[model samples]
Target: MSKPRKPKGRPVSGWLILDKPVDFGSTEAVSKIKWLFNAQKAGHAGTLDPLASGMLPIALGDATKTVPYVMDGRKIYEFTVTWGEERSTDDLEGEVTQSSDARPTEEAIRALLPSYTGVISQVPPQFSAIKIAGERAYDLARDGETVEIPSREVEIFRLTLLKCEADRAWFEVECGKGTYVRSLARDFGRELGCYGHISELRRSFVAPFAEDTMVPLAELAALEKIEDRDERLAALDAFLIDTGEALSGLPHIAITEDQAHRLRMGNPILLRGRNAPVSEADAFATAGGKLVAIGEIGEGEFRPRRVFT
Candidate 1:
């Protein structure tokens, strides 16, 4: 039998809350971080558009397993809607599709805020990542083909008008996963009798991570100047948040080393004490402050689901 192929690169693990710069794609950021760290595995919790700058949580090595949790968390964005012209892509990148000389008053825009709050149906932009028959909508849009896109429900926890100018209005929003700020700007313009598009957008926060935790791309890039390879890598590693920190939202229990060993060996460990959980669909276990496994609790036992190496 042929020998199993070993993966290259260091087994670095943790979350890197990147303050992605505008015009840089999410995939490109991940690739660049992967190269800089020379990590064996890497992934991002969510996709931030090239034109939008803000908090983008990236997972390295074992932290990649927890990406779904971060992706499902709520996001907060501060955006500016430029009235008078709506673009094809819903942003400045695309050509103007519709235009109007009329503009909305501050009072008029504030009056419409309540209608956009809470659960509402939204249609994604034509230049979106939504798939149509296995092909990306953006690809079809670039080809000059217009397809009917269905509307889906998205929850907006909070929407506030920050400031309003003659032709531009700034707003901040806290919304659930899959909510599109660009679409909100588009819809607002249509309803107010003035066409609009996103002039500036920045994600300020993602759930389970603080807005202040983000590290800029330029700050990380500057670390590349260190002469010694080990010293340089160490400088980069300092910024990594513990992998277990990402699961702060989930129920957690600290187990003994023996229990961690059993979990690592793909075995379940009994839960002791009356306060122990009777049942749980999702939870995580740690030992010596290190993540041991993410699993379930039932019948007074913790069953290992995904064990960390």
Candidate 2:
């Protein structure tokens, strides 16, 4: 009997900011995108809870190299805190562990905003991905084991009370890496004398990407449904941002094609005049309008740290 050959989609590269929908996990989103693109490699910068939805930067092939940069950048979130109920997971996913009739007045909520802004201590939810010992904290929590999550200092650049009604309060938070919106909602309810849990959460922006740049999964699925394979591939490719877009925060220098070839060969090339880095630091080097490598510049030489090719 003849065995069938496995299909390999294609070797693709670039970044796709997915407008992740509710009920979709980050890994599931990545898998779907990988299958759609038939990409050899794929990854996401930040982890978003299945209950939350919005900007999720998915990297393909070489673009995966820039995941760390995107993950560390500031994130903006819009969420609603539903008062009178506190959940074990700090969100609607868990059982209500506490409740109260008290609700904070708009004036009081506004006054408390400053305290959450700037650097503050935060304890991540026990039913979270955070590792405790060698196992996931969420695993221990689900097994009914005691979990004490350590508090850490996280930066909240801006925390604003957008709107507040009787049972739900809307907020927008611009925070640095490691800040949890669910935790913020939980803390706000506690501070206001009414227990609460996150009812709705959506990420509007992450680092270099804005809400407008994100494409919903439904749109991508529609594009994939196109009958013509070439047309479908071309349409899908149109949404990918250049790999260099991910390196927007880094300084760049132009190098000769020969230098680029050398860099690809794992060799360092000397820099001169304006092509030199401002100081002894790591920066991006381009050749013929294409990204060559992210290299270290020192003593008039560019040593390739991570070559693109």
Which segments of candidate 2 are over 4 A away from where they belong?
1-7, 278-281
Over 1-309, each residue of candidate 1 has an lDDT whose tens digit, in order, gives: 999989989999999999999999999999999999989999998798899999999999999999988998999999999999999999999999999999999999999999999999999999999998989999999999998888999999999999989999999999999998999999999999998999999999998899999999999999899989999999999999999888899899999999999999999999999789889998999999999999999999999889998
lDDT of 2 by residue, 122-221 (tens): 9998888888898898999999987888999999999988888999999999999999888998998898899889999999999888789999999999
User: Residue 102 lDDT in model 1?
Assistant: 100
TM-score of each: 0.97, 0.94
Highest-scoring model, lDDT: 1
Instruction: List CA RMSD, all candidates.
Output: 1.2, 2.9
Predict model 2's lDDT versus the native.
0.90
Candidate 1: give the clashing pairs: none
